[model samples]
Target: MRKKGFTLIELIISMAIIAILAAILVPNISSYIKKANNEKAKDIAAIVFSNSMRSYMKDGKFQREDVLNNINEDLNIKDNEVDVASLYDSEITVDFKVSKLEYEVKIDGEQSRYDFKQK
Candidate 1:
């Protein structure tokens, strides 16, 4: 007479198969998340650049940290900061720099995604 349940060998084999599948899938999922974060960071960088340009035109100065909330109001963005933990592991910051005749917008921790000078 035999029991109806799976044998120990069968269960172990099934568990090993699941483990292998997880090993393969986990990294892929992580990579996908990182790619998504990079894409989001790029898009946000563009928005920040344009926002800075607009603010500079209207206010004669670059957007500063203190006025980020006001910019958020003008832009209707959810918040002054962004969180992309998959790539940056912290909230992304929108920083600005101004020279005599130009302003720069930088997304902290994500300089590679920034390209404000492009047409």
Candidate 2:
């Protein structure tokens, strides 16, 4: 009588199927994870924008260093992962980069850019 259990060939076939599925799914999952990370970085940049607006309301001025410092303090933005540049109303352009995503929030609502690159 045959044992009521998987045969060696059956076990090997199941493992092969699992490996093939993994090989097909891994790259798609990886791509999705990278997209999610990029979106999270953009969310942080939006937080920076809100903080800048709040600071402007309070101080009647917008300064790059001050806003960046507030983000570091109030929002606990990681210093090593983010950098700020020329992000004030008085400035012609606002540039803030978090992780690999760069955003330019323009006062005139024109000439803004959001792009990803290795940093």
lDDT of 1 by residue, 1-119 (tens): 97799989999999999999999999999888866655554555576655545544565444454236545756555542332111232213454322211223443322233433211
- In angstroms, give how far residue 36 of model 2 lies from its true place: 1.9
lDDT of 2 by residue, 74-104 (tens): 6675675555555446442345565455655
lDDT accuracy of residue 102 in candidate 1: 24
Best by lDDT: 2
Q: What's the lDDT for candidate 2?
A: 0.61
Off by over 4 Å in 2: 1-8, 87-89, 92-119
- Residue 27's lDDT within candidate 2 is 100
Query: Which stretches in model 1 have alpha-carbon errors above 4 Å?
Result: 63-67, 74-93, 96-104, 107-119
lDDT to native, each model: 0.49, 0.61
